[model samples]
Target: MCYFLGAMPLQCVSGIFVLYSLCLLSFSPHCDGGNILVYPVDGSHWINMKILLQELHTRGHNISVIRSSTSWYIPEESPLYTSITIEMDEDVEDFFDVFLQEHLRAQRDGTSLLTFFKLTKGFLSMIARAHLLWSDATNQILNNKTLVKSLKDSQYDLVLVDPAIAPGVVLAKHLKLPLVLNVRWITSGEGHFVLAPSPLSYIPVPGSGSTDNMSFFQRVKNMFFYSLVLFQEKFLVGPIYDAMCDKYIEGGCNIVSLLQEADIWLFRSDFVFDFPRPTMPNAVYIGGFQCKPAQPLPADLEDFVQSAGEHGVIIMSLGTLVNTLPKEVTEEIASVFAKMPQKVIWKHKGEQPSTLGNNTLIVDWMPQKDLLGHPQIKVFVAHGGTNGVQEAIYHGVPVLGIPLFFDQYDNLLRLQERGAAKIIHLADVNGDTFEEGIKEVLYKDSYRQNMHRLSRLHKDQPLAPMDKAVFWVEYVIRNKGAAQLRTGAYKMPWYSYHSLDVLLFLISSTTLIFFSIIVMVRYLCYRRRNTKPKQS
Candidate 1:
């Protein structure tokens, strides 16, 4: 009777087991949400981070985003995470505005060389402003006892930073969190040195636009550009970042050391879209992760596309930065579009061109990706921005690129090399050349075919880019920084990574052996001659 009283019903036993399993699941690290901090630099970088972070948030991770106030493309607030905005000083902000205006004017009015010079000056100004703003923000954050206390109390799991903004490194150090760098550009500048084996012999510099298949002279040119970039970053920009680190960090760290310690790097490119190159195990390519399926075009836009009938449509946009073209250039584009049988959608912010055609629709903004994905769209006229290029490739649409400044020229050059696009430089834009470029892309089946082939390869990944990125991010959390994936190359000196030490040793040994052989032969010949003469 005592044994029977102690026995439980089968259903009661099952319920107890289920409750115990649930408790264990709740306590497991993999099953729980992680705290993630995301900080993206200004410009198109915000778009890339938003896509990744939003997906992570949807998967139940806690997210916190901090961005500069000067960002032109401010993201909408999400209920899933906290948003922090850092404001720059009025003078710095004004300077940036003036610099942008001058830079754009240079792009429109000057030769490529002059444009490059102006842009270079503007870039230096931008670096200075970035330093000042970051310094001010860092001091503010450190001085605010409440903010500092909160950051310490929160205990973030990981900090995802943009390397373009150097101060983010110092902030990560202050928080004492593991770092994951999200680089939006294909080229990561000096950061590439520590991330992986980037041989300049094949890997072109950011603005050079040369491909991996370069001639002897081109390779030399590539090396020169590479050296110039490294010098600028190391001597010109490194001090600003170091100074910030010195002020805030207890031990103080430089940019090179900070990057070496990074746990993971997510590049906004893939081999299918970019040239094949060696990447570290920790480096992941999630190029088109931000791309989405085409949404239905607005009624007016749909109507405009349908009006063209069999000729299809063409979409032209110069991206967010170059909102307007020079009056003469605008007229050239307008005139070219007028001659085309297809309907044209041009995204322009400046005054309407005098040659504005009846077949063209000029708007301030267009859903670029959605339009690219449209079935009837035949060609994309673009400024060759990375995002735009990626979108055009994803949709298998051919491009007529009008590259202006920065990496635009390089980006178009790559596309042109791939037979997927043709480029007409902004400075060289005229009605005849612009018209020819448009016609060449439109009439040529090779351009469309190559783009389609690339699109297939891009989509053939084992996992979707977004899934791949999220899995790695989570993997880092689950594995506690995933140190095993890190390459020893980063820890090695530059000479060691390139086998320069081994090469130098081989060269020295060969020279010494050759010298010793020569000396021994001379001594034997001298002795033989002297002995023979004495005998005579």
Candidate 2:
């Protein structure tokens, strides 16, 4: 009787398990016509988008991607993990290479940290034209009475716009669908420096005080330099960008304006890096969303690292854009590494340094994420790019950030502030500073503890970033743009947006004026009394 009772329930439990497994299996393949549109092009965007698309395909969600011709044209050397080979047309390749060459030139000139700021503005303006043209083209395609009639004729549940390629914003506006804006970095206000005037805060004067420190002659010269950029953005950037879109694609479409209306704004960095903004709910920090790296290291690199013994090896990478170090600086760094207690593995994409020290292993590329996960990697010398920063934290490795350009300073500073890393000034990146920063990161227990603390926080995320991104993408389809999470800050005035600062300034000014009037009144009374009389 007891055996028969147990067997009856066992069959029922098995039946339920089989049904659940079949349901999961039904949803797992990539198909062509999904009810989603992804845009604003980048490798990261493509990678994350592909994962979400794959999951959607498995789960039976339809997905379509709209990108610039050059969006997926990455060379084999860059670290991209995608199953599909992104084919690019010849004209697109030409346009992309030209843009890339110009972009590389801008990075090379951005050697000093402060100068990097100026160079970044020029670089952003350069890319902005390409993006504007691309976005215009995308919008034109979407607005084609035939295409629009057909798409509206059918159904696209939602629009997913990657901030990099950016045209997703335009299509979202045109389609009038709920928009999900995926920001891969510190975009938003920072990207505006390309199109708008730089505030007085961007002016580089030595003193910590106000802009009033400059001599009259120097201030005039600085103003001229500042105006040159402002004038260029006002007359050239906005108009030329407008003209390109107006002629080729959509008329009067602005990326920033589109972002203001996005149903959700997603950032790739952790919340610790993003400021506490009012739109915090719509702003989700989905950092380190990529598939986990396998524990095994590259056999060749692993063997080499193992041979180093107790000293361990240091891994250095300045990321893809600035992969090549100037020979002079490379030699100086090599000099320091040669004398150090550790072995060095530098990812040098250019020619190997002529100096060729015995302690260093210079390779064209290293699987950064995989290498960082390796047990043998002792310390990381990095450029403090967002991707690199997150990887370092995820692996609990200490970093020495040699920031070169574009939000790198801010990233490095944030990491340094968090006690996870040390910063090496670009101008001072000679042997002493580089060596000292490295030694500190390698030797310090506090640095390791701090990085571990962040790693724990990163791991403790409510849901993995990839899962969160995929869930949100599907949620947008089901609910038509997670509108419940959208804050009304988009409609607020700029002054009102920064109201606390405005209030502080007003109160300080009013207090100063009131005190001055009081002093003046007392002085006048004393003067009149003195003149009228000692006689009284």
Candidate 3:
């Protein structure tokens, strides 16, 4: 006899029955399975999300990633997750390339004034590019009936969004899913403006590079930068976001409002890496969370490190965006490495300089974490990317930073302040200067000791960053949304948040009382003088 239970076949032989339980179990979803949709901004953003999402997948979640077609950091194919590619126009990609090239060129050749102008222009261009990209993505999602239907049908339990890019909020709102923010930078962007406390008096503005212990003038400067950021967000980026939402998002949501609805915020920084600041319960710091145990190096690479002997080794990488350096700069770097006693492994995509050093090995790519974790590494020569800096901290390696742009300067500055790193600007990077920087970091025991101290602090968290991220992610899914964790400040108006209304009322009342007393005293004096005027 044959029987079926929920599409499972059962067999009865000689009055004994056997059920095909394995088949049912194989078809069933993991006990903690939940559909998670991730919207990443760019290649760099994707790299950070990839780490957190991979962990989520390992813990029985179904993940789907949506990225631009022109994204450079595409993840390897995995049966456990799915990828959705969105098309970007060739012209748009070309504009970004040209813009970055011009900016780098300006930094390489121009004076400070010229560089400032070029950076301003570059920032404007970047804003335009972001607006265009978000607009295109919004239109694509709204216009494609099949894609829209498939997305709605997927029934995602939660959405992991890169708050740097505004379209993620639109997608989450469209799907009506609980939102989780993954901030890929050390500095808080719009997410902090909405959810986190940002007191300009102590907390330096993102690009200011100032520390918490600021002088009176420095605090004024910090306040200026904060105001500039607010102006840009409101007058510049606001219109673009509003237009995009007005076209696609029903009821036309504001970007800040959308972000404030987020259930959890994961920042890519820790107290060790970033200056101490007040954070809300919903905000979780997961700096170096992407770092993992070092795998054995490739045989050839292992042999190269081993060959260095007692002199140790240094790793030079400018992160992903800066794959190629100017030929002159490259030659200078190579020449500097040639004189160093330690072996150098540089990640360079440009043509090898004619003066390339014999002591230096240039590879197109490297497993940076693995190389940093190696016992042979003496110091890391980096562009001061957050990921690179955090990895260096995790491995307890001192850094020689040659910061290029954006948060790289601030990141390097923080490390420099922490006594773990030194920075050499790109314009100041010559053979002699580069060599001096490397020598200082390599010879300085203080740098190494400080790095080790920070590493201990970073590792001393109650829950590992990955586990904390995973737990919160699951918490959002289990609880629908963690509204209780949200700060009440988000709902307060700007006047109420800063107590400006109360201050203004007090000032107005005091002014009114003072004026009334002065007028009454003047009238009494005038009346007394007039009554006695006849006798005078």
Q: How badly does each model clash, as a count of residue pairs?
A: 0, 10, 0
Candidate 3 segments whose C-alpha is farther than 4 A from its true place:
1-31, 75-77, 91-93, 185-190, 504-536
lDDT of 1 by residue, 1-536 (tens): 22352497777778777999999988854725888877777667777777788889889999887755665665547686787776656445466657666766776675667667668767765765666577676577767779878887888888888777756667787887788888743222634555767887888877666888888999888887787677666776777777877877788878777776778888888877777777787888888888778999999889999899999999999887767877888888898899889999999997999998899999999999899999999999998888999888888999999886667777788788889999887767898888888999999899999999878888888988888888878877776686787767666777997899999999999999999999999999999988885535
lDDT (10s digit) by residue, model 3, range 1-536 = 24544444433442243245666778653347889988876656768887887788888899988876766666536565798877766435567667767767777885586677668668766765676566676668767989989998998999998877767777788778899989843112434555677787888776676888899999988887777677666776777777766876788877777788889988888889887777788898888999877889999999999999999999999887777778899988888888888898999986888887788999999999999999999999999988999999998999999887777888988899999999988888898898888899999899999999988988888888998888888889888889898778777888998999999999999999999999999999999988884754
The list of candidate 1 runs beyond 4 A from truth reads 1-31, 69-71, 75-77, 91-97, 107-115, 185-191, 495-536
TM-score of 1: 0.86
Cα deviation of 336 in candidate 3 (Å)?
1.4
Q: Who is ahead in TM-score, 1 or 2? A: 1
Candidates in descending TM-score order: 3, 1, 2
| C-alpha RMSD of each candidate structure in angstroms | 6.5, 9.2, 8.8
Identify the candidate with maximal lDDT. Answer: 3
Please tell me which model should have the higher lDDT, number 1 or number 3: 3
Q: Between prediction 1 and prediction 2, which has the larger lDDT?
A: 1
Q: What is the lDDT of residue 50 in candidate 3?
A: 79
- Report every candidate's CA lDDT: 0.79, 0.64, 0.81
Clashes of 2: 10
